[model samples]
Target chain A: MEAAVEMKGISHWFGKVQVIHDVDLSVEKGEIFGLLGPSGSGKTTLVKMMTGLLRPSKGVVQLNGEKMPSLKQLRQFGFMAQSDALYSELTGRENLDFFASLYGMSRKDRHLRMNHVLDMVDLTAYASRPVNTYSGGMKRRLSLAASLIHEPELIILDEPTVGIDPVLRQSIWSELNRLRNHGVTIIVTTHVMDEAEKCGHLALLRDGRMMAEDIPSQLKSKLGVSSIEEVFLHYGGGARA
Target chain B: MNTAAVVKRILKQFHRDKRSVALMVAAPLLVLTLMWLVLDTETSAVKLAAVDVPAQVVESIETEGITVTVMDEAEAEEKLNEAEIGGVLQWEDGAPFVILEGSDPNTSGTIRSTLQKQLSEQNASMEWEYWNGSSELGLFDYVGPALIGFFVFFFVFIVGGVSFLRERTQGTLERLLASPVRRSEIVFGYLGGFGLFTVVQSIIIAAYSIYVLDVFMAGNFLYVLLVTILMALTALSLGTLVSTFAGNEFQMIQFIPLVIVPQVFFSGLFPTEGLAEWVQVVGNLMPLTYGAEALRDIMLRGSSFESFQVEVYILLGFTTLFTVLNIAALKKHRPL
Candidate 1:
């Protein structure tokens, strides 16, 4: 079986500056895979390549054994960018309904899935309110809900829980766990260490290079550290054992 | 397919953002109304010095509403130098000799035309025979169609550009790409959605100008409507396509002078007879040029549908070109 997503010798450049260096990655199905890096570390660029939102300067990005940036394969994934992408002029339900139709969901399924996702994000009460009236945390939750509206098999989330409250963040992660249980493969990029620990497998990236990739506990054991932060700090510092 | 969803979302957004919708409709209407009012009020009386002219001539000119003053030649010259009177009209050996002050073109034009009408009417020597449009056609009648084309293009371009730019800044465009929707669908969706809105806007603006402002109309009303709608669609596509290059809302607005304002200069607003050959060629590249020309042909000249087919094809060609480019530009965000 094909890995959920694969990147081989991937390199990207914007003008003279290189944003993502040669990197190889393979993400399996039913896994909560985390890409951890600081700002400007190229995590966003790397993840964008996987979605076919960007083409690598050199190399291939494949999802489910298909060459990526393919329109047919694009239907299989959901995306939440680093910014809250909701249309402030639109109501939460209307925004969700719009995306639902883009995904070719039937009207009945849209009505059903909209309710489910709104409930998942706990935004049912504010469904009718314009998104501009939504608080920062509420907007984040709404964006999360929109991504899951199509029930995509592979979901790519970039900094999904930044401004979310702790309680909401916990619920969102728990929901991610539930999706994973149902065989949904998730690729998430974040600088938050706590969010990193929730991932089943982690790739520690620094300066566009994949510093390390392993299960969280295995990385911790190898580094002889209690926390993923220490492992990141050490590897990010280029102190390889 | 998914274009309908985009259209639906845009309509809903328009409903939510009532202020923008109002700005799109009302701003143009207000400006057009002001222009018509100004055109109507162009009958402002011109001050002229009547010298060596018989009292009968002065009385006939006065009856036509020109303010005439009794003065000698040197006194009239002094008043003309002082910018007091627009012109001096005198009779010399049965022929009329008129010395115009001629500083202000608008006032000068009024004085000359008023003098001509008075002379023609009082002596009954000239027959005013209009070939196409009547002698009743006002300046507003000539410019009104171009103004309609311009404002429709201006408003729709800004709104369309800004709305599409917001999609990128707000990140919604990235989300759309990740879905099953194709890049072309996004462009078509925007075109369809905003296209419908502009159609209503064109009708309201054109009707208000023709009926309420009483601008001269020689051709079919539906043809004017057709030209305005086509012009708006061209603007819609160009604006959305240009927005892909903009990094923010302000950048999109910056394109107004560079992209839109130039179209007005070449849109038959001013007479291009004295313009450079290259300058006219540049105007030909602007979609508004075709639209404005088509409007002028239909509204002023009462030309046949064949006269407008060139402009119609050019506008549609521009629409198709911009839409194709926009779909390609979106690949910068999502390659598929």
Candidate 2:
């Protein structure tokens, strides 16, 4: 019932060019929420603001009722950037272990959590191989595994399934469902209409503005559309801004 | 515990990158060996032109490694003016009057000493006078320690700066920032990681220069190691600090002229006394000046710990300041 992340009238700019302008979003606890938009639609900027990685030019962001960019609230959120930022020179397991330790995990907890995430991502067999040796999909899975290593209450993933195969994408979606069932709140940013439909709730973004926010099915029914894609087209004008 | 993780991560990365390991070990040695060969070649023959000297004096000069050429006074003066002759000898009041070309003090001193020694053997009553004091040290000895400092500073600064910058531009830095780690922890992580490798680098380079290259080592080996390690720390901190301003490897390399090269000129490698007073003062502000001065004093002058305490502290201050600034710089990445 409680909102996991809330942004009120948030506006951001890179130099003079505005990226996110007077936007409002709320992600509820224990739900899979997606911010659906094409690349350069300010999805990343909005996610960064939600995770407290960037300061808003105007207005406020709150995480679990605590004012953000608070370090305390930041500690409670796990973020996976759009880029697969794993250390290429380090093995997948080593990368996971390093990030886990950064969150001050005890040795026993880190060991258990690392093995859990490796299994969750189905990367247990390749855990010892360096990340540079991983194929594109494997690296993406490993990066996702790393973001989930600490098992934080809220996880923010930016374009997480961009390069993954359909079968692997299905498995990742199932895993997100499983995490949600365990009361974890997730914020996923993607332009894939099918993925947008998978989220329990969706915030459709365009031109740095929130076009609509509701359950995906409800949004489609309200827009009198057969699919989430048509609803996005209705709001996005089906073309470049 | 965080420190242990940092050290382990760095060591693991170092082990994986074997080519960089080889470069860290071999590059300095290769350059140093070439310098040794170039600086240790045999001395060249001293050429002399004597005018109106007795045959006995000419024979004496010839005995002491001088190639003597007999010419009239006019011709001798002409040769001296042309710098084709090292010295000119003419007899006045029953004694030899020496007129020496004064460029290149080493050659001038060598000629004067060779001629005076020859004259003394010919007659024990021959009086000797030097054109200048013999207290000045050799040119090689003066610049040798500074060169050691310069190379160490240069190579380490460049390699460390570009590598750290790569970590950022490649997105690894952003990954680290996203973790729950404090910014200071990341700064210390880099310092500890690079510090371990540089310690070994410093040891190998300093030991090679001292024992193999046979550079002057008037002070204790431990002191030399201490100074070198301190110099390396300053370079490491400075490199990482400056890396924040650079967006990529090329931009990082561009900083060498603006940041690293001027330090060498001010590092006492060349005589800065002839420079304007303000220019000399600018040299004093450089970290390399203190590092090179301390290194040379320990290696050449046999200075004790007490003598170099001020320089040691200044280097420590620079490293600390740069490291703190580096942590502050990371705020640009993650404000938290």
TM-score of each candidate? 0.86, 0.83
| Clashes (candidate 2) | 0
lDDT (tens digit, per residue) of candidate 1 on B235-273: 999999999889899999899999999899888666563
Candidate topping lDDT:
1
Strongest candidate by TM-score? 1
Reference contacts preserved by each model:
0.93, 0.63
Q: What is the C-alpha lDDT profile of model 2 across A42-145, one tens digit per residue?
A: 99988877877788899899999888877677678788888888888899999999989888899899999999999999999999999999999999899889
Q: Each predicted complex: what DockQ? A: 0.71, 0.55
**What are the per-residue Cα lDDT tens digits for candidate 2 across B1-336?**
666677678778889988766666678778766776665322345677777788977897787777888999888777664456656777767877777654324455677678766676645554333222222434445456776776677777877787678778767677777666678887788778878888898889888877887776678888887877888789988998999898788888899999988998888655464579999889988999998888866776566798788999999999999999998988888788
What is the per-residue lDDT of model 1 for residues A82-169, given as tens digits with 9 covering 90 to 100?
8988899889999999988988899999999999999998999999999999999999988999889989999999989887789988
**RMSD to native for every prediction?**
8.7, 8.6
